[model samples]
Target: MVGLGTMGAGIAETLAHRGLAVVGVERDHESLRRARARLAHSLDRAQGHGRLDPPSREDLLARIGLGTDLAAVADCDLVIEAIDERMDAKAALFARLDALCPPGTVLVTNTSSLSVTELAAGTGRPARVLGMHWFNPAPVMGLVEVVRTVVTDPDALEAVVALAGAAGKTAVVAADRAGFIVNALLFGYLNNAVRMVESRFATREDVDAAMRLGCGHPMGPLALLDLIGLDAAQAILASMYEQTGDHRHAPAPLLGQLVAAGLLGRKAGRGFYPYTAPDSGEVVGTGTAVGTGTAVGTGTAAAVEVPPVRRVGVVGSGTMALGIAEVLARSGHEVIVRARRPDAADGVRARVRTSLDAAVAKGRLSEQDRDGALSRLRATTDLGDLGGCDLVLEAVVEDLAVKRELFTDLDKVARPGAVLATTTSSLPVIDCAMATSRPEDVVGMHWFNPAPAMRLVEIVPTVLTGETAIAGALGLARAAGRHPVRCADRAGFIVNALLFPYLNDAVRMVEANYATIDDIDTAMTVGCGHPLGPFALADVVGLDVTLAITRSLYEQFREPAYVPAPLLEHLVRAGFLGRKTGRGFREHRRR
Candidate 1:
């Protein structure tokens, strides 16, 4: 071990308890003292719990040797470097170890963000050097990213994989990217959440609750952000931005401001929300520090924003449209739904009736509520009926031309200043904006596939779109009992833009045979606390949709990084669309 920090000490102790003698080296004596104390205290607790026998406890403690010299690691077959994430610092340390240790010693850096290739070059031993990126509190975190540079020896890679298993960890080989798998997927979503807060699309509570309740995330993004200090998040974002050059990785302004205020997360008693129990994420303090945009105090912002959505026009003839219409009616809005024809309107009404009836059966909707929802729901094939509506949302096809045509027609026909929005998953909103005379009224209200079931609705606004237009769209979405996240009009918006790439990467992981589907999903759900693994969620979110979004992102960002995996494209081409198609990542039975 290279350093006796929290991660290094945990790894050293884990190895020692596994009956592997560890030469734990630190730059100074004080860190060594702390690490030694931590190891002894940890073993004592384990012994008290009957997890460690007296003989084994003594043997394990005796195996860990504290030293300041890197020369002591020469006899060891494997030496893992757990230290601060500075490229130059890591490179220098690895170079010294390469000079001191035996040629056969597999040298590894516990670097989560630095380049493995650069570190290998610094050591002048490219074949032996690789990245052994471990999660925080190494002994407890089950997943480890075993990063391989081009020159890394296959034997060395296999050795580390076996060693990690021996240490009771599941290792996944990750390409030398900024965050590898978990953090890359995690931090992008976290940054987007901050962007939503910056735009005031919803309150922090709504945002967090939407994710927790709607998406089944272990922790809400805002609360998770507070746990991960702004400075720490900034560092990861900086690395991700350097790698992919996507604006999504660019940390939001509020993150820096909070960090500057010394509210660097739970460690400093605050970040996005004030922490009462520091790292525990329990609310102990009330209110947020006052700022220019939203000065939150007593857990609420001073600006009591009044939204304008008295009447909402819902355009669709599908299940999603009916679900959206149902939610709109349930939220006390007069919902006027438009279909392509009279028969299409009939089908929509029937679907809405069925959905409402089901809700009533589940006791989610009362007899009175269902009847009232039906009363608010009026279906027509004509767009002309939506003239007096406060907001008009077309939940039609996910095509650009069709959406543009609808917005163009709505621009001329709908009442003046009424917000015209499209439920486009991947189409550019600016294209729809340009089609309309009142571009300021055009926005994108992308609810997840199941509008009623999924809690998140990404509210997208182009540069030409007015504040009221944006706010009105979000207001109606929230009024529909949905959590709306405001985002700039981009290719994939927030959720899909950040989500699809990670899914594609998981496919790449599968392509390499890193782990089976069950292993990967298990690691993600059990290890990272995600509600659904990427592959399974990909199945729920159609493969065709994922492909379309990935292609759009690739075209917009011009980052080859966003290209959909060939495997994903193949599945889509094979007509395996997911649960809707009865087959996707895992085969499903047809109804």
Candidate 2:
């Protein structure tokens, strides 16, 4: 291993612990000493954790050699380059290794963002050069992308893959390109987060929480970028943007600003969030003191007293309405649901009863609790029945006109100062607010599907919305055990705004045939640690829904990146609406 930085040291430790005779090379004795010390610390930690016994750890360390000369690996069978990401430096190192090492020796580079083919072609032995892109904290992360250039020998690729496997890492092979697979998709998402904050769509904390709680991501995009080092992330993103010419891959302007200001994340003790010390994960300051654009209720909702919400009214008899009603009733609120027709109201009540019964059978709800919740919920066709509601949530279809007209009715029936909220995932909440007489009482309470199970609820406030309404919506979300992330009344709000574009990009990738559906999904899952790949998620969300959200984003933003993928439209046109129709980018079994 050449260039013993953190990644190089980790790689050295991984290989040594796997019983491989390894040599770590650095530019000078000081560098080599530092690398050795780092490896020792890591090994000591492993031993303390019982991952390695003392004798085994000593034996492993004994098998490793350190050197400061290129010729030290001349007789070795392999020379893996874990050097800096600069292409000129990598090319120069590879040329020297090609000259000094034996002709049969395979040369591997552990670069994550540079072009492997260009680097390989710089050496006389292009066929022997390959890339082994390992994730950070190499010993901890299981993934190792074995990148093969066009001129790389199949034997050389096989050797690297075998080596990665022997070192107990999951190896994924991809053609040489900027970011290969993981960083390609990963950085685009991260850059979008920066844009979200830069544009003030949401604050850093709320953006991070949306992905963490909403999507099950371990960290939010901005937090992950902070951990990645702002300068390094900007470099990788610049490389991807220059190579792919995709605006989505372009580094957010805020990233460059932060890097220039020396707030390069955990290393600098500050970036998106402030830290108490360098390399410390403990954040010190509140993240509300952000740049330009409205704060969007990120850090904490204001201290205003949330209006009482004992009696709640839900309009429409759709699945969303039933779910919302169930959530409200279970949360100790008297939920009155109004449908357009008596039969529709009856159907809504029946569905809610069935869902509660199933919950009881599954032991998710006790028999008494289920009965109590059912008694609190009532369905009616009379819109006047909602007159006594303290909070009225509209869970109608995703049509602006229909919602506007419903808001006009809700304003008249709901009592004075009643918080009027719309669960519109795609439409603008302001349109509904404008239709109501008291726009200050109209806010958005966008819930993810299966409101009872999903934790995220976007509390969107329009310009006309009041503080009390926002607080009430936030309070109601908390009452139902949901994580409330506040944002402006923008199209797609928090989750859908960030999520749909990614899904569309995945569709574009499949349409371009750059990779198969399985390859893309596997690359994201194995490479980025996403709970599910974009393609799989699109299928689960329904391709039609994905297309509608994508269209909404495009129509709202007018950005080329948000444009709906032709493939998505084609699939929807062909009646392949993902899991609902059992067919989409990938086939799914009918539920």
Q: Using TM-score as the measure, which candidate wins?
A: 2
Tens digits of lDDT, candidate 2, 1-591: 898999999998889889999888899989888998898899888888989898998899897888897788898888888887888899899889988988899998998888888888888888998989888899998888888877889899899999999999888777776787678667887888888888887878888999888887878988888798999999999999888898878888888898889999999998888888999888886745335355564434468886567999998888888998998899899999999987897787689989999999998999999889999999899999999988999888888899999899888888899999988888988888999889999988988888778899888888778888888888888888888887777888878888887787777766765556776787778767889999889888898889988999999889897889998899999999888898988888887
RMSD of each: 5.4, 2.3
lDDT of 1: 0.79
TM-score for predicted model 2 compared with the true structure: 0.94
- What would the TM-score be for candidate 1 when compared with the true structure? 0.76
**Relative to the true structure, how large is the alpha-carbon lDDT of every model?**
0.79, 0.85
* Alpha carbon RMSD to native, model 1: 5.4
For model 2, the superposed segments whose C-alpha errors exceed 4 Å read 287-301
Cα deviation in Å at residue 474, candidate 1? Answer: 4.4
Top-lDDT candidate index: 2
